[model samples]
Target: MFPTRAYSRDAEAIVALRDDLARWQVASGIVQWKPGEVTADQVRDQIAEQQWWLLRDDGAISATVRVLEDDPTIWDDLVAPGTGDALYVHGLMVRRTHRGRGLGGVMLEWVESRVRDAGRTTLRLDCAAANTSLRAYYVGLGFTELGEREFPPPYKTLARFEKPVG
Candidate 1:
């Protein structure tokens, strides 16, 4: 298994990783996250809240993701009221240089383990509706599309997905 740990310091490194991916998305015409949208402060808060995790390879951060107990903004309308039967994953990012190395699946499996450890039966996540490749990737990973939702300005339609955990 790839070495994994909860995010503790160097929030800037995570931000940099996300910005790099955002730039790559734009250059590749992927309508996903935007550059300069992720800030160190936000990362720090996430770390402080114990919501972030990192996967390291050869002592360097290879990927990162945020796992949360609840995400009302994107999931409230979809999940049953007051049922905390799942863990939500957000901001999954892999370093550009580390793409195609299965790090994304590794990190997701780690999160699935966490979900099981937490006694949750499901893992949930969402991506931009315009990102067909990513949506298909999630589907290929055993995640079933829950539905789609449209939010206010600055946020496009989002496709939500969930996978059952042991």
Candidate 2:
């Protein structure tokens, strides 16, 4: 069985998890942009805001996700206004060694639980429009495509998704 642990802000485990996420983001081809550009300070800020979570297994960080309290400005043109009732997820990544073991779904469920616990009615996230497989993965997790928008430079088109939570 896979044991999971929740890590708090600026914890060593979380730093390691962020490093792992940077590496996987490059290797997975999901991020054509530079890796390791997001600093520990940025991560700590998110964590301090209660917007980040690090999931662990066997004492090692296995995955990381950020639950945003507000909808990103970039997504404003795509989704309808006043959608802040949902928690927006960002930077979800699983370590390469543990890929394809169903951990992604587990992490997603955990995110859903967090939304429900917060009295939120929905969970939302976005994927690069070019990443069809990644979009499919989110859909498999029960997220429905809401809309798409083009963001200039570095990152281009992004497809937004949302799933209702109880």
Q: 62-134, model 1: which lDDT tens digit per residue?
A: 8888889988889878776457899999989888888899888988998899889989899999999999999
lDDT of 2 by residue, 1-166 (tens): 3324334444555656556666766687865235555677777666667776666766666777777777757666655666658788887777778888887787788888878988888888887787788888999889999878888876768888989998
Q: Which regions of candidate 1 are displaced past 4 Å?
A: 6-8, 80-82
Scored by lDDT, the top model is 1
**lDDT, model 1, position 65:** 85
How does model 1 score by TM-score?
Answer: 0.94
Tell me the lDDT of candidate 1. Answer: 0.88
Clashes of 1: 0
Kindly give the stretch of ten consecutive residues in candidate 2 with the minimal lDDT sum: 1-10
Kindly report which residue stretches of model 2 are placed more than 4 angstroms away from their true locations once superposed: 1-33, 78-83
